[model samples]
Target: MYSIFGVAWFSDPRKLFALVRQRLNLGGVFVFSQPPGSLGAYGLQGMYKGGFAGPAMYTYRFSYTHAMWRSLLLSAGLRRSRDLLHEAPKPDHIGTSDCPSRVPE
Candidate 1:
């Protein structure tokens, strides 16, 4: 099993997905936590205050919709597995999902 905690915000998820897929065995699990889709809908702005974000916050934080997440996983040969997935309900809480392809190794 492989897990990515709260680090996606500052890294390229596509590259990470490819790396994870290459490393995981059949039936192995992959998990990650990220900001909710709603945040993307609102245009990722004002996440920080008092000039803490400086001029390049976009390079440090990122957000995407649920559909986009599914697409990214699919492109990396992963399928969502409810049994291995969990998501928080709070509006400000980061959402999480898991993927595990059913095809034989």
Candidate 2:
């Protein structure tokens, strides 16, 4: 099993995916949780709304939407599997605080 956490946001995801695919044992699982709309596609849309830009958008590289991510995994030879996942809280519904006070670690 592997958990890539936040590193994929700033690096070459294709390279990362290739490395992970090479290193994993048969049937090994790879998992990660990215904040909603972190891709350049989404970030550009959100930029007009004054939302923060994620690393993917900042560098103008290594970006993916949910669909793109799925396709990428498949192209990397990873099988798609059903798993329970939660949707991120919508910005308008996340209480009165719209911005974080500190950068996430």
Give the number of the best model, judged by lDDT. 1
Q: After superposition, how far is residue 87 of candidate 1 from its true place, in Å?
A: 7.5
Model 2 worst lDDT window (10 residues): 95-104
TM-scores for all predictions = 0.58, 0.56
Report the C-alpha lDDT of model 1 over 1-105, residue by residue, as the tens digit. Answer: 544545454456677677777878787777665445554362233345236556644244445666676677778777766434466687756656543443226
Sum up the clashes in candidate 2: 0
Candidate 2, residue 6: how far the Cα is off, in Å: 1.3
Q: What stretches of model 2 exceed 4 Å from their correct place?
A: 38-61, 89-105
Candidate 2 structure quality by residue, lDDT tens digits, 1-105 = 433335454446666666767777777776655444542454222222224665444233344565666666667766546433454477543111111011111
Model 2 scores a TM of: 0.56
The runs of at least 3 residues in candidate 1 whose Cα sits more than 4 Å from the true structure, single-residue gaps closed, are 1-5, 38-59, 83-105
Candidate 2 residue 57 C-alpha distance from true site, Å: 15
